[model samples]
Target chain A: MDELIINSELHQYKIMIGNRIRYDINTLLPKTYSTILVITDDKVAEKYLSEVMSNLQAENIFTSIIPAGEQSKSFALFEKLHTEALTYGLDRESLIIALGGGVVGDLAGFVAATYMRGIDYIQMPTTILAHDSSVGGKVAINHQLGKNLIGSFYPPKAVLYDIDTLSTLPRSQVRSGYAELIKEGLIADEELFQSILSSDLMSLSQDQLHNHIRSGIKIKAAIVEADEKEKGMRKYLNLGHTLGHALETTLGYGVLTHGEAIGIGLLFSMYVSESVYTIKLPYEPLYRWLLNNNYPLFLEQLHVNDLITLMKTDKKTLNHHIQMVLLKNVGEPVIKEISDEDMSSYLKQFLRKLVIA
Target chain B: MDELIINSELHQYKIMIGNRIRYDINTLLPKTYSTILVITDDKVAEKYLSEVMSNLQAENIFTSIIPAGEQSKSFALFEKLHTEALTYGLDRESLIIALGGGVVGDLAGFVAATYMRGIDYIQMPTTILAHDSSVGGKVAINHQLGKNLIGSFYPPKAVLYDIDTLSTLPRSQVRSGYAELIKEGLIADEELFQSILSSDLMSLSQDQLHNHIRSGIKIKAAIVEADEKEKGMRKYLNLGHTLGHALETTLGYGVLTHGEAIGIGLLFSMYVSESVYTIKLPYEPLYRWLLNNNYPLFLEQLHVNDLITLMKTDKKTLNHHIQMVLLKNVGEPVIKEISDEDMSSYLKQFLRKLVIA
Candidate 1:
């Protein structure tokens, strides 16, 4: 029973992380609610919906299953969830349980965020990648042009991350989750970073996964607490997300798992840091890890000009300037505004370095 | 220009009111927005879209128009607006200008509320009914089961109310807008109630209309400030709304204007107060006024049982208990839980009294 409390400006809630946390769903939930609508994707619903439902002690509990993937976070799918909630007569007092990975959490959290203006929702993250998303209140859907292009910063009432659910995740997904895990270590904790870099990426015990996820969440939670509305410190969490989102969007969403796309973005950011910020980040080892994991870091398939256009159009870029997060060192993250010309030059250099590494 | 500032937990900004105030849209809006997406309806677009667009000093401005009426607040329409917004490339730095009545405000506000998790939205109210809807941060879209069934509490960055727009509104709409206006007075201000009752319901000068709207907004603003989340005193603003929403929903939305339905509901709530709270409510003048204005207080078309059922299912009700807000007198409101049986009896008695009055 590894439970941590998240204190946010909107509301403070518990993030229960353990192997079998979903078993305590009855006690974890509020004693009273008009209805409960559990929103999950097809993949998660097929695997764990019945188990979640069977564990629920309350009445008027309904499940809405969206199709599996990033497409589920579309405006249409977001609308479908609202229709389901309306059908269930889920009122303000009703609870929305987002029971899946990042897609389910982001999509369902968004539905809860705007359904009747906002309602209470809990996150039951079933993927390691959701360890980052489950903690931060930032939830959104995607537009055809961009990933997470449409959404809100509505936080969940609590996050219940069960490591047991990770057992069924594909190796790519575990790697995807590691993107954020490593992000936490890179921007905030040197010891955590070195420990994570030394650990086995292909296989790890549940305890290691738990520790990594917890450390990532702690770093994220503190940053979120400092700037819940993303007014300041929250940008550090987007350490790799600037180009990460652009790469994800340019390649078309869901082509690369979020963490994988971000893994490359993280490398690009560190590469930029070495040049733009004059910070000596050991880029070779991290670049090799991504390469060994079969991450497509090669830019031959993706045009630099096209990717730069996507970066300029990124939601994070204000005033049409790309502000990419860079590392001053292992424990120091800085946001630097990179011009397209400079970004293209850096991309050429970074890819050249990636080939050498 | 009559400018007043609203201080709320979400955010605060000025509510600018006057005739042809949209002329100042350039200086009034924040200079930093990358783009502006003006969301209006067919009717408002036909009349004032260009004026708003031309008034914009910013180069990147776009407009989206839905059909005019409550129908535009549907899930489908809401999704369409998101699509339009996505098509427009509206980003986090962009602004959403809701330029119509409450439908546009609610629908567009709900869209902006969730668009990229919310960007700054400015309420450019073109209807009198919007005087109530515009001021409060309560924005929503309707479900088939209920009005405002899906929405959130995202306040606009500012409200720009042009009284000139109200001049073109149909008499029915002006009357519809009065429901919330009268509600504000009835719940909070004895003097305002007396003055409104003394004035010609159908005829008023533009200045007089502005004063009533401003006064109504002031009362609503005070309540909203006290209970932004509607946890306590803000429920007072729903004085006529409990049965009002039920009556509106039961009547088939759009059949009766929001005010006409709430007029009947207000009469019913007063009757309930007389019985349940033993409050001395001056019911005759208001009932006579309703008759004079052709507000359908006639219960011949409505079934008491159906209305009761609707009330029981109202979003305001909790745990199947229909708690109706009752007034002890003008400026003294109380929320009293009315059982199904009692509400039905009161409906029967209230109709009998309306017929006699």
Candidate 2:
């Protein structure tokens, strides 16, 4: 097992990445809680809930299984989970275990964040997409207005990333989840990026997948430690997220999985970066790589004007100026404020190329 | 104007208390924001919205007004505010000014807390009850099952407490607000407690009210600074809140103002203290004081068992044990976990006395 510690101004927690790390949960807990509530999605619960529950060492244990997918990250579900926690008599000393992918982790992590003005929770991520979401402690529920519009930077007590669970994920989900790993490489680690680009992401050996996931988490952990609130350097972590979020919002959440939207976003960001910086980037190769992986890269149904407007509403956008993370080099990400005229122009060129291809 | 600095692990904020401090808002802002959204209740907006709007120094200013009272702290309103914020193009660099009493402060503060994963907000408390709520960073919205069940401990950038706003409050509201000031005294400052006890709380002069409010904020600031998350010393600030919250939840919120419920809780905590610790408390004199001030001191509409059941669901309760803040003496407070049997007996005795009186 590989272990890493995430340091935020508010908390310092560990991330354990290995095969079947779920069983090590007892050893990872900071202390014994009064009661433990495991929050997962229905799909994840059907697969691993019983196994995880049997391994948890707590006197009183309860489970709240939400419907699987991005729709689960809604205010209605957020409220329902809190009601369930209260019904189960979960208190200050209680623990909430968020078990599943990004949707479950984000929703359940947020429930723990605001439940009684915050309590301890562990992220037991069961999908590859969760490799990024579970580590950074950026928990939130989507607002009707935008994705992650209502959220908090509340860190979890610990994260147990059991690779064994990833075996159940479908091929499309794996491709979607791998986009974040690619994002991690593009932002900070060129070697990791090159390795992922060279390898067939769909059929990586268990050991190879473990190394890439560990690298992605370490890069994220380092950035979060320096800027937990995203006042400065942390904004770089939103590499493709500005447009990715806009796409997710424009498409209506769950129309495209978060990672799939991000896969398209990564290509658009690279195109914008090359245009804005007048620098050469592996834009074509990366685009071809995404297509090869079966990522839904075409946004023919949407207009550049709509996506631009939605991008302005992004959390990263400031003063209604679309601030996008663009790469000057493979490992160098810069946040540039793109005016509507410039953003619309770049977005048009990028979308036009997608249509041609 | 009197200034007190509240120190928390996450952030440090200032509390400016005086007559008409609302006009001094621009001076108190830590920095200029991109946009400013003022969130207040309809009642407060009628009196001060235009004046506040005229005084605020921002290029873009927007106001979101909700219905007055505790009902405003619902999930519906919470979601509405976030939607309004997004509609107005408020972003990470924008600020939210909570421009009413506790309801507005809590709802707006929670919006600011989770808006774009937290942003800068200032608390412009418009009532005496806010003297306590405004100082602490405990921001939240109410759940259907309980009060403040959904929330975060995100502190404001600053607090502008204008004593001038108190003149608009009704006599009942004054009595309701004064109970918290009295709680501040009972838990900490004996001299402040004695001064308040001797005075006619209903009719204090401007200078006297300013001094008492400042002192209350100082006591609270000290406690919050020592323990921001209510992990230890901060729980002392909940001296009257355990039963106080139970009463508010039982009474269906807004039926009894928060401070009024707290006034009754103060009396109950004293009663429990006397029973469990075998110590003398000024229960009778305090009871008479509450009656003299026209605080609703009777619970004939409710049963002790129902309140007890509700109390068990309190955020402070641990492992199904009712942990309450009890005064050992006038100036000292301690948290004691009372058995269900002891709690039921003490609650019945306290109610019986209230009935006879």
Candidate 3:
């Protein structure tokens, strides 16, 4: 297993990334903690929790499972976990192990952060999508009004990214997770962007995939280190999330995977970059490439004005102004305020042009 | 306004304690942030939100009010605040100002910590009881089965303790809050303990009472500084809290203020400490002192077994062992693992003794 140390302004934690690393938790977890409470979702608990449980061999390991999906990451579910943690006897010395994807990580990490005002927790990511979500100490739950509206910036003691579990993930989930990789490249890495574009979007060997995942994580770690709270440079990572969250909320969260919504949002941001940012880039070729790779742009179906209204609820929006991360060029992003008129006009042009294609 | 900077290994914050200090929020708050969101419970919001809003005159200032009670300090209420915040256009640059007592401070501070992966927030304490709750930054919500089962250790940007608002608090609430002062004295300050016992518990002059409030906060702040995450010294703050939470949960939270339940719990813990540690103290005097102060030591009403069962849900319990903080002697506390048999027998003796008196 390869280990990466992420040293951010708020906290520093170790991330273990490799195959079958979930069973090797003892190498990283603290020996003093007598018991562990592994929090997971119904979907993942049925599949992978027992394997993780046997590996830890905890004197008193407990499990609390909630339903799977963004909907389950609510205040009600959080309360249930809290009561369960308390009922099972979690103290300062007890560890919380989050054993699932991003939703599970965010929710369980939040439970750990708040349960008795913080305790140690380990992340055993069960999805390829979690590779991006599992890193960067951002833990939170969604409010009905907005995506990820309630949460904390609490890091885990260690992250066990067992790649072997990724084989169990659905194809759509894999594609969805890959969207964040594209986002990492769009913000910082020119070489990574080129690599993603050149390689087959699907059907990659394990070594090549791991290299790509590590590159994405490196870029994210650098951003988090620079600004753990997203006051400045960290906003770059929200390249597609501002619109992506709006789509997820407005279109209904369960309708699309987090990465899939972001994929569509990323395409819209490129168009914004092309028109409003006025950045010179190879846009036509990139658009054609996405189309070839089966990225359904969905421009013809979505309403522009309605989308802008939904975007207002995003955390990135400042003072009623809709702010977006627009690409100055490939591998270069800048936060820009988009006027409603300009955004609507741009969306109209893209819809007309894409429909004719 | 007296501004005290608390420098701890994990957290550092300024505590501004004085009268009518809300006016200084602009100067007291971090100059980096632009917007502010005032969070309060419905009771305090009705009385004081306008005053708070008028002082911190920002174009983007917004107010959110939740139902007032321990019941409101749940995931449901937290989600309400989260949704309200999003609706009000809160962003990373925004600040959340908690304008009520413990419930507001805990819930709002939690919302700030979680919203957008952590934002800045200030505690503008409106009630005298808040003097203890506002300072330490232990923000949380209660689950259905237990109190403070879900929470985080995110300190506020600054705590503003305005003495004027205490005038609006009912005598019952003020008396309820005084239990914490007695608790503070019991654990660490013999001088304060004697002074409180000698003074008129219900009728101390405002200026004289503020001094005690400040002293209690000072004691709490010092303990928090020594151990921000409750690894060691901070556990002393949980002196009455373990059994107190059980009493509050068992009796039903609204039936008693947090302080009242803790008051009863304190007596029980003292009895347990005297027996377990071979430390003898005058039980009659202690029981009489609590009665004179209007603290109801209803040993006959509550079942020992039920209280013990509820205590098992406390986060302080490790591996089914309830680690209770007991008074070795007044001003010295010892956290010891006690069996259900020991606690049950002690409760029976204490009840029998109270009946004879």
Candidate 4:
């Protein structure tokens, strides 16, 4: 088993990664909670809830099963979970366990963040995408207008990443999850990025997948430790998310998985970086890699103006200026405010390139 | 203007107290926000919205006015404010000004705490009751089941308490606001408590009120600074809130203003303290003062079992044990876990005492 410690201003917690690490959950807990509330989605519950519950030894145990998907991260469900916690008599000494992917982690983490003005929670990420969401204390529910529009930076007590859970993820989910690992590489780790470019992401050995996930989390942990609140260097983590979130909002959530949308966004960011900096980049090689890996690289003929409007509304946008994280080079990311005219022109150019590629 | 600095783990901000300090809002701002969203209730908007808006210098400014009172601190208004923020193109660099009493401060502060994973917000308290809420950073929206069940401990960039705004407050509002001042005294300052006991709470001169409010804030500021997250000494501030919140929830929120309910909770804590510690207290004097000041001193025909149930569900309750903040002596508070059996009998005795008094 491998463990990485994440240090934030409010907390310091461990991210334990290994096969069947879920069973060792008892060891990772900061203390024995009087009651334990495990929040998972219906899909994950069907597969792992019983096993996790049996392993979790607490005097009082309760489980809230939300419907499986991005839609679960809504205000209604967030309230429902708090209602459940209250109904079950959970208190300051109680603990919450988020036992699913990014959706559960974000929703449950958010519930823990605000429930009784904060409580202790642990992240048991069942999917690869959660590797990114789980480490940082950024837990939130989506508003009708945008994704993660309501949330806070509250860290978890611990994160137990059981690799055994990943064996059940669909290929699309794996593809979606890998996009974040690719983001970690593009922003800060050239060797990791180069390794991913050279390998078949779908057919990675258990050891290879484990190593990459660890690398991604380590990179994320360092950035978060330095800037827990996203005041400065943390913007690098949003390298592809500026356009990535717009695509998710425009395409309608769930049409493209978070990572799938980010895959296309990663390509767009590189294309814009190359143009804005007038520097040579390995754009064609990366494009071919995404296409070869079956990442949906097309924008579905969406209007550039609509995409620009969505980008302008992103949380990262400052003063209505769309701040896109572009690569000064691989292993280096810089935030640049793209003017509407420049952004419009860049979108047109990128769309043209996408069609030709 | 009197300025008090609040230092927390994540932030350090000033609480400016004086008459008509709202007009100097520009000088208190940390920086020029690209846009500003002023969140106030309909009632407050009618009285002070235009004036606050005129004083607020920003390129773009927007206002969201919910219906007045505690009902505004609901999930619906919280969501509505986020929608307004997104629609107004408010961003990370934007500022949210909470321009009302505790209701607006809590709802708006919560919105700021979560919008785009938190933006900057300042408290412009227009009511005396807000002297407590505005400084603490305990921002939240109430759930259907409990008060402040869903919230976070997010401090504001600045708190501008304009004593001038209190001129138009109703007698009920004034009485309600003073309960918190009484609580600060009961927990930390005997002089403040004795002074309050002697004064006609309904008819304090401006200077007396100012001194009392300043003293209450300084007491609160000291506790919050020592324990920002309420892991220790901060719970002392909840000397009355355990039962106080139960009263509000039991009677239904608008029936008795928060401070009025807390006033009763304060008496109950004293009675419980006198019994549990086998000590004499100034219960008679405090009780007489509350009665003379027209603060509602009775619980109407509510069952002890129901109130006990409510108290058990309080956020302070640990492992299903009812934790009440009781006075060891004047200005010294201690948390005690009251047995359900003892709690029920105490409630009966307290009810009987109220009837006789």
Candidate 5:
């Protein structure tokens, strides 16, 4: 597989996709860095660390394994990683590699972001969900109040994705990861949406997976290039993330994977868009597909007030109002500040309607 | 009092050099920011925080006070500030004002730098030593292993230097702060050097104090403007800090004020410069002036090997060798990589020579 390149303001890097990429990660690293620290989770470390180290045989590499899951995205872990980096004698010339899913990527990337102010880092994602986080520079850890509440917009030097690792992921994980791919299609490409819609997405061929991820990355790369610091166009990437993050924060992180929450958020966004903006979207089809795929739409568990409260604290919120990205149709997204009455009314309507499908 | 401007790459901010800036800080901030969080030490908060908040009567402002001294510059404090910021309902539009000496400026500025990734911050430095740290936007918290081991290159939105606060400083502090003023002269301007050498530095007129600070800041601003991220010319500004930081880290922080450590480092640098680069400097006069001003030369307690070990871990040590800033003459600085043997030999000779002086 060829590399997909992202040209950001302060950094320019490539996303190299292939099967068993762990063996080639060493070659992708910058020549100046003699010291490499690979930060992964216990699960991923057991499965893939040695594979990555096999290629890094000639390098002075150090590996630190964090506990698996969202709980590891913490201040304590961030501090611990820095201590480990210091203990391993990692210097400014050294590099830190994130070698797991988004949780590991977010934790290790943030550690790299704050360690010695900032240091060079690479992302070698071993999960399907990491495709989105590994591309963008938005590295962060979860605060008690919210997910990604404390973080920096730090871009990675490279993103090495090994598709073979996806085989090890549960079916739910694979389906959840596909939500962002759907978002990229809905927000930017109508043809990509229609193409995926016509297919049996559950059993995607290697070529299908490649095209989906490449297109998703291309959409992400273009948006980030225009607004690397998330000033304007980059807000579109948070299409399903506002309510998605709110759910993640309120419901507890590990209860639902990122893509599952985002899956529900995406459906609700379409409903709200139709209600508020009179934007005609494929809300019925998308909602059906979401439920059929085992993504639990936990609308009954959440309240409008709690979601609204969480939405207010969002980094995207300006002047205490939620700036949501609503689509008129596939490939046509617009940002709007919704009133409280409209948000509350829409949530009531959506929850009332959810009894059937 | 007029605002002296610092033009950086992404941000250009003012250094409001005056006698009483605490009262008028609200007027200096951007009107768009509705939320303000002031990060200060207990000592400074007692003396200055109320006055600052009095002016910010219309804005929803918050204040957090930490214990005084270098210990406050820790990862624990950094994490606590973020938790406090989140608890205080501070959003992305919020501004954090650092109202203390270099400790507050570095610690609080780092909080703002990493909070929600990056946020706006103002530096209200309440000490003479803070003038140097406040200007460059090189904010950081100290690691247990080293001072400023964990930090970033995030610049503050403004530097509010209130010279009246220097009146609260002890004479030792005042003299210690003067070392950086001398360094600004040595690295960039000989005229500033000559002016300082011929004067009663302990009891300067207010106008003399203003001129010295302004000249020092001008020297700093120019260097930072040329190299905001410390890639090239900015290395010169660290004329004495390579050894200076090592001493502060190994000997324990706050044991010697930053200026006191830098003063001794400056003396040793000149000696090494003379030996290696044949740089003609007034080493005798500088040494006498240092001792005359109560700057302790702690030569007997420190060993050459320990200092060399600390220097090896310095951020400036490129490719496992010390990249020190040496001067050919006043205002002529160059970066050099000194060998371990060369470093040990120079330290032994420098320590031996200190016995006579």
Candidate 6:
């Protein structure tokens, strides 16, 4: 299959999506690096690293695998990666390949970024959920206090998406990954959302899955290209992320996959959007679709006040004011500067209420 | 004294050195940033931070201070700076000002470079020793096994050197700072070496100190401008650093300041240079001068084999081959590819004699 391209205009890089492209990593690696360090998690490495390694038969490749988990993206992990990289004799002329999902990407990108001021890195995302997280070059790791509290805007040399790897993804991850696709559509492509909602998502053929991932990536690409540093238009990409990140942080990460929290947060935004905007959304149908896909819309088990407190601590908050991305409808998002008073009522009374079919 | 101007061609930044320029920080701050975060150490905060804060009087100026030590410049510290920058409401529109010596500069520069990919930073170096450390924009921190194991080559927007702060420097620090001046003269400027050797460095007139600092900075700036990422010419700057950093790592930091370690390392290099090159050097005179100045050169009590083992792990080593910058003679340096055979004997026999001197 031909690689689908997501061009980020600001940074001037392309995200290429295809199947089995991990076999051709050198085509993307910059020739300047004398050595290559492949950073991966234990799970991903055990499953697929040898395939990635096979491509660089002539090159010097070093692999450092950490235990697979969000917890691995810690100071201790960063220190280990630094020591191992040095022990393997990696230098400024080395290329660090992040060969797993978001945790690996964030930690590895950070390691590469700060390794010698910075070095080159190629994103070889393995998880189905990494489809959305892998693009836009926002590499970060969770802190003790919050998720993605530490990171950099270090763009990858190129991103290689191998669809073949997604075949190993568990069904739960497939559902989780769909939330970001839903997000991409909600932010800019209403037609894409309709197509996804109307389709038999679980039974998608390889070609169908590739197209869906590409479309979602393209939507994200356009936004990032317009505003690479989240100065303006890129903020729109946080459609469900502001509330979603708060929910993830409050609930504690690793408990819920990122997309799952955003799935719940996406429904909450629908309530805010319906009340505050002119666009009329199919709220009941959308909620039903989320339920059908196994998303928890009413997070009653989570303390409402705690979520509010977590939202206040969000990186998106300015002067303690919650800045929410409220959708005009299914396809359009408008950033609403919601007052704390109105946000609490919106979350407690309306967001908690569910339309059970 | 007039401010010195050194244009770094590699990174393309103009370094401004003067006395009390912290009073004029607003002029140096790039207009691109809407806000600024000042990254400092606790010790520096107690010493010169008030002046730095007062100069950046804008309401958007925020300050975050970490513990004052080399220990604080870890992966954990890097994460804290990243988080605090976010917590202080920093965005892409923000700038980070490093208001201390090498530690603050390295950590803050790494933070700015990695926070959201990269941001702008200004170096307000307060120490007299920072005359050499501040320029070239090589920001880094220590790892467990070594110093500056994790870092980036992210240049600051500008460096404003205020000489007035040097008045507060301890006497030991002033002597330590002059080692770089001697280093500059040894490698590139014969006249600079003679001038330092002839003069009483213990009591320098303000103008004299400024002239020496400016000359050293100009040399660093010229080299950095040519090889910003240390591809070739910048390796010369690591003359003492290879063995020096090893010494510091082996003996443990805090036991010896960076310049003190380098001072002894420089003497060691001189011995190596004498063996490999025909260049004439007054090594005995220089050693006497350093001893008179109360410089601590680790000798009899320290293990020679341990230091050599540490040197093997130095970043300057490639494929187990130690690359060293040896003085061809006064004012000329030749980067030699040293063998392990020569390295072992040079430390045991020659270094033992020098230490007894």
What are the lDDT scores of the predictions, listed in order? 0.82, 0.88, 0.79, 0.90, 0.83, 0.76
**Would you list the clashing residue pairs of candidate 1?**
A116-B151, A117-B151, A117-B152, A151-B116, A151-B117, A152-B117
Model 5: clashing residue pairs? A117-B151
In CAPRI terms, model 3 is classed as medium
Better of 4 and 6 by TM-score: 4
Q: Over the stretch B1-357, how does candidate 2's per-residue lDDT look in tens digits?
A: 887887778777888877887787787788988699999999999999998888888889999999998988888898899999999999998999999999999999999999988989999998888888888898998876678888999999999888998988888778877888899999888778877777786678888788888888889999888888888988898898888998899888877888989998999999889987899999988888888878888775577788888888888889899999999999899999988888888888888888788
Give fnat (model 1).
0.69
Cα deviation in Å at residue B165, candidate 3?
Answer: 2.2
Residues A1-357 of candidate 6 have per-residue lDDT tens digits of 454444453235557777777877767654546678999998998888898888774346799998887788787788788889888877566788899988898899888877756677878888767876677778776666566666666778778888988988876678778888888888888887887787665687887778788888888777877776776778777777867887878777777778888887777787788888755676677677778777766554666677777776665665567889888666667777888788878877654475333
Q: Candidate 1, residues A1-357: lDDT per residue as tens digits?
A: 777787887888888888887887878874566588898888888889999999886668898988888878887887778878776777668899999999999999988887766889999999988988888798988876677767788888888888899999998898899888889889898777877777776778888888888888888888888888876778888888878888888877778889988998898888788887666787888877777766667654567888887787666677677888888888888878888889889877776776665
Of the true interface contacts, the fraction found in model 3 is 0.87
Number of the top-ranking candidate, with lDDT as the measure: 4
- Model 2 C-alpha lDDT per residue in residues A1-357, reported as the tens digit of each score: 888987777778888888987776787787887599999999999999999888888989999999998988998998899999999999998999999999999999999999999999999998888998898889998886678888999999999999989988998788888899999999999998988888786688888888889999999999989888888998998888888898888888877888898888888899988887888898888888888878887675678888888888789877888888999999899989989998888877878888888
Which ranges in model 2 have alpha carbons more than 4 Å from their true place? none
Chain A TM-score by candidate, in order: 0.96, 0.98, 0.94, 0.98, 0.96, 0.93
Off by over 4 Å in 5: A19-21, A30-32, A57-59, A298-300, A340-342
Docking class of 4: high
Candidate achieving higher lDDT, 3 or 6: 3
Tens digits of per-residue lDDT for model 6, B112-222: 876655677888887767777678777887777777777777678788888888877777678778888888888788787777777676787888878788888878877
**Candidate 5 lDDT tens digits, B159-237:** 8888887777777677777889989999998988878776676777888888888889889888888898787988888
Query: Which numbered prediction scores highest in DockQ against the true structure?
Result: 2
| lDDT by residue for model 4 (B1-357), tens | 999999877788999998888888887788888699998888889999999899889899998888998888898888888898899988888899999999999999999999988889999998889999998789988877788888999999999888999999999999998899999999899899988888996678999989999999999999999988888899999988887898899899899999999998899999999999999989999888889999888667988888888888777888778888999999889988889999999989988998888
Models sorted by lDDT, best on top = 4, 2, 5, 1, 3, 6
**Candidate 4, position A91, lDDT:** 87
Per candidate, native contacts kept equal 0.69, 0.97, 0.87, 0.92, 0.57, 0.47
